[model samples]
Target: MKVILVFLLALGINLVFAYLLALGFFYVAEYFFGVCLTVKEVFFLWVFLLVVAPLIKLKFRSEE
Candidate 1:
Protein backbone atom coordinates (compact mmCIF):
# COMPACT_ATOMS: atom_id res chain seq x y z
CA MET A 1 0.00 0.00 0.00
CA LYS A 2 2.77 2.44 0.81
CA VAL A 3 4.52 1.64 -2.43
CA ILE A 4 1.31 2.13 -4.38
CA LEU A 5 0.67 5.44 -2.69
CA VAL A 6 4.16 6.66 -3.46
CA PHE A 7 3.82 5.65 -7.10
CA LEU A 8 0.51 7.45 -7.36
CA LEU A 9 1.95 10.55 -5.79
CA ALA A 10 4.87 10.57 -8.21
CA LEU A 11 2.54 10.14 -11.16
CA GLY A 12 0.36 12.99 -9.95
CA ILE A 13 3.33 15.28 -9.48
CA ASN A 14 4.62 14.54 -12.98
CA LEU A 15 1.23 15.29 -14.50
CA VAL A 16 1.06 18.61 -12.68
CA PHE A 17 4.55 19.55 -13.79
CA ALA A 18 3.82 18.62 -17.39
CA TYR A 19 0.61 20.63 -17.41
CA LEU A 20 2.27 23.69 -15.93
CA LEU A 21 5.12 23.47 -18.42
CA ALA A 22 2.72 23.15 -21.32
CA LEU A 23 0.71 26.11 -20.14
CA GLY A 24 3.88 28.11 -19.63
CA PHE A 25 4.91 27.42 -23.20
CA PHE A 26 1.48 28.35 -24.45
CA TYR A 27 1.61 31.74 -22.83
CA VAL A 28 5.22 32.41 -23.71
CA ALA A 29 4.70 31.49 -27.35
CA GLU A 30 1.57 33.59 -27.59
CA TYR A 31 3.35 36.56 -26.11
CA PHE A 32 6.52 36.30 -28.15
CA PHE A 33 5.51 34.63 -31.40
CA GLY A 34 1.72 34.80 -31.51
CA VAL A 35 1.52 31.02 -31.75
CA CYS A 36 0.22 28.08 -29.70
CA LEU A 37 1.56 24.64 -29.03
CA THR A 38 0.54 21.83 -31.27
CA VAL A 39 -0.78 18.60 -29.80
CA LYS A 40 2.57 16.98 -30.53
CA GLU A 41 4.36 19.70 -28.63
CA VAL A 42 2.20 19.17 -25.55
CA PHE A 43 2.65 15.43 -25.71
CA PHE A 44 6.39 15.81 -25.97
CA LEU A 45 6.46 18.05 -22.94
CA TRP A 46 4.47 15.52 -20.91
CA VAL A 47 6.80 12.71 -21.87
CA PHE A 48 9.82 14.84 -21.15
CA LEU A 49 8.52 15.58 -17.67
CA LEU A 50 7.94 11.87 -17.00
CA VAL A 51 11.55 11.16 -17.93
CA VAL A 52 12.98 14.07 -15.94
CA ALA A 53 10.88 14.14 -12.76
CA PRO A 54 11.97 10.72 -11.42
CA LEU A 55 15.65 11.47 -11.85
CA ILE A 56 15.18 14.75 -9.99
CA LYS A 57 13.27 12.98 -7.23
CA LEU A 58 16.04 10.43 -6.82
CA LYS A 59 18.75 13.06 -6.82
CA PHE A 60 17.06 14.95 -3.98
CA ARG A 61 16.52 11.74 -2.02
CA SER A 62 20.20 10.84 -2.18
CA GLU A 63 21.22 14.25 -0.78
CA GLU A 64 19.36 13.50 2.45
Candidate 2:
Protein backbone atom coordinates (compact mmCIF):
# COMPACT_ATOMS: atom_id res chain seq x y z
CA MET A 1 0.00 0.00 0.00
CA LYS A 2 2.86 2.34 0.75
CA VAL A 3 4.38 1.62 -2.64
CA ILE A 4 1.03 2.24 -4.29
CA LEU A 5 0.75 5.52 -2.45
CA VAL A 6 4.22 6.51 -3.58
CA PHE A 7 3.30 5.69 -7.16
CA LEU A 8 0.23 7.87 -6.88
CA LEU A 9 2.22 10.71 -5.37
CA ALA A 10 4.89 10.42 -8.03
CA LEU A 11 2.27 10.37 -10.74
CA GLY A 12 0.62 13.45 -9.31
CA ILE A 13 3.90 15.33 -9.11
CA ASN A 14 4.75 14.29 -12.66
CA LEU A 15 1.43 15.69 -13.82
CA VAL A 16 1.94 19.01 -12.06
CA PHE A 17 5.44 19.25 -13.50
CA ALA A 18 4.18 18.44 -16.96
CA TYR A 19 1.47 21.06 -16.75
CA LEU A 20 3.91 23.75 -15.66
CA LEU A 21 6.34 22.74 -18.41
CA ALA A 22 3.56 22.85 -20.97
CA LEU A 23 2.45 26.22 -19.73
CA GLY A 24 5.97 27.50 -20.24
CA PHE A 25 6.07 25.88 -23.66
CA PHE A 26 2.98 27.86 -24.55
CA TYR A 27 5.06 31.01 -24.53
CA VAL A 28 7.67 29.48 -26.86
CA ALA A 29 4.98 27.86 -28.93
CA GLU A 30 3.14 31.07 -29.45
CA TYR A 31 6.35 32.70 -30.62
CA PHE A 32 7.88 29.88 -32.67
CA PHE A 33 5.89 26.68 -33.01
CA GLY A 34 2.62 28.61 -33.17
CA VAL A 35 0.95 25.63 -31.56
CA CYS A 36 -1.59 25.50 -28.76
CA LEU A 37 -2.81 22.54 -26.74
CA THR A 38 -6.31 21.25 -26.22
CA VAL A 39 -7.56 19.33 -23.17
CA LYS A 40 -7.09 15.93 -24.80
CA GLU A 41 -3.56 16.70 -25.83
CA VAL A 42 -2.76 17.80 -22.32
CA PHE A 43 -3.37 14.29 -21.04
CA PHE A 44 -0.35 13.10 -23.02
CA LEU A 45 1.58 13.63 -19.82
CA TRP A 46 -0.10 10.53 -18.37
CA VAL A 47 1.97 8.25 -20.58
CA PHE A 48 5.12 9.56 -18.98
CA LEU A 49 3.75 9.38 -15.44
CA LEU A 50 2.57 5.79 -15.90
CA VAL A 51 5.97 4.66 -17.12
CA VAL A 52 7.76 6.54 -14.37
CA ALA A 53 5.54 5.23 -11.56
CA PRO A 54 6.39 1.61 -12.30
CA LEU A 55 10.08 2.24 -12.72
CA ILE A 56 10.10 3.69 -9.22
CA LYS A 57 8.40 0.60 -7.81
CA LEU A 58 10.96 -1.62 -9.45
CA LYS A 59 13.84 0.43 -8.10
CA PHE A 60 12.66 0.06 -4.51
CA ARG A 61 11.72 -3.60 -4.88
CA SER A 62 15.37 -4.60 -5.14
CA GLU A 63 16.21 -2.59 -2.02
CA GLU A 64 13.71 -4.62 -0.04
Candidate 3:
Protein backbone atom coordinates (compact mmCIF):
# COMPACT_ATOMS: atom_id res chain seq x y z
CA MET A 1 0.00 0.00 0.00
CA LYS A 2 2.74 2.45 0.84
CA VAL A 3 4.63 1.75 -2.35
CA ILE A 4 1.49 2.18 -4.43
CA LEU A 5 0.71 5.49 -2.74
CA VAL A 6 4.19 6.83 -3.34
CA PHE A 7 4.06 5.72 -6.97
CA LEU A 8 0.79 7.53 -7.54
CA LEU A 9 2.13 10.74 -6.01
CA ALA A 10 5.29 10.56 -8.07
CA LEU A 11 3.35 9.94 -11.26
CA GLY A 12 1.17 12.96 -10.72
CA ILE A 13 4.13 15.17 -9.91
CA ASN A 14 6.11 13.99 -12.93
CA LEU A 15 3.24 14.65 -15.30
CA VAL A 16 2.70 18.18 -14.07
CA PHE A 17 6.42 18.94 -14.01
CA ALA A 18 6.83 17.54 -17.52
CA TYR A 19 3.91 19.58 -18.83
CA LEU A 20 5.28 22.77 -17.31
CA LEU A 21 8.72 22.09 -18.73
CA ALA A 22 7.21 21.54 -22.18
CA LEU A 23 5.32 24.79 -21.90
CA GLY A 24 8.49 26.71 -21.06
CA PHE A 25 10.46 25.13 -23.89
CA PHE A 26 7.74 25.86 -26.42
CA TYR A 27 7.65 29.43 -25.24
CA VAL A 28 11.36 29.76 -25.85
CA ALA A 29 11.04 28.16 -29.29
CA GLU A 30 8.35 30.59 -30.26
CA TYR A 31 10.44 33.48 -29.00
CA PHE A 32 13.40 32.48 -31.12
CA PHE A 33 11.91 30.63 -34.11
CA GLY A 34 8.61 32.48 -34.37
CA VAL A 35 6.71 29.19 -34.53
CA CYS A 36 3.86 28.68 -32.12
CA LEU A 37 2.74 25.38 -30.58
CA THR A 38 -0.64 24.46 -29.19
CA VAL A 39 -0.24 23.69 -25.50
CA LYS A 40 -2.78 20.86 -25.45
CA GLU A 41 -1.11 18.88 -28.20
CA VAL A 42 2.40 19.69 -27.04
CA PHE A 43 1.73 18.68 -23.45
CA PHE A 44 -0.15 15.52 -24.40
CA LEU A 45 2.54 13.88 -26.51
CA TRP A 46 5.96 15.31 -25.77
CA VAL A 47 5.56 15.38 -22.01
CA PHE A 48 4.45 11.76 -21.92
CA LEU A 49 7.33 10.66 -24.11
CA LEU A 50 9.88 12.73 -22.19
CA VAL A 51 8.97 11.07 -18.92
CA VAL A 52 8.49 7.51 -20.21
CA ALA A 53 11.47 7.37 -22.54
CA PRO A 54 14.03 8.00 -19.83
CA LEU A 55 12.33 5.53 -17.51
CA ILE A 56 12.54 2.87 -20.23
CA LYS A 57 16.21 3.60 -20.85
CA LEU A 58 17.19 3.74 -17.19
CA LYS A 59 15.27 0.69 -16.05
CA PHE A 60 18.37 -1.21 -14.91
CA ARG A 61 20.65 1.59 -13.79
CA SER A 62 19.22 1.99 -10.31
CA GLU A 63 20.17 -1.57 -9.44
CA GLU A 64 23.85 -0.66 -9.59
lDDT of 1 at 46: 69
Clash totals for all models, in order?
Answer: 0, 0, 0
Kindly report the root-mean-square deviation of model 2 from the true structure over all alpha carbons: 6.1
> Sorted by lDDT, highest first, which candidate order results?
1, 3, 2
lDDT of 3: 0.72
How does model 3 score by TM-score?
0.60
Stronger candidate by TM-score (2 vs 3):
3
Which candidate's TM-score is highest?
Answer: 1
> TM-score order of candidates, best first?
1, 3, 2
Off by over 4 Å in 3: 39-41, 48-64
Q: Each candidate's lDDT (Cα)?
A: 0.81, 0.65, 0.72
Q: Per-residue error at 10 for model 3, in Å?
A: 1.0
Q: What is the TM-score of each candidate against the true structure?
A: 0.67, 0.50, 0.60
TM-score of 1: 0.67
Which regions of candidate 2 deviate over 4 angstroms? 31-64
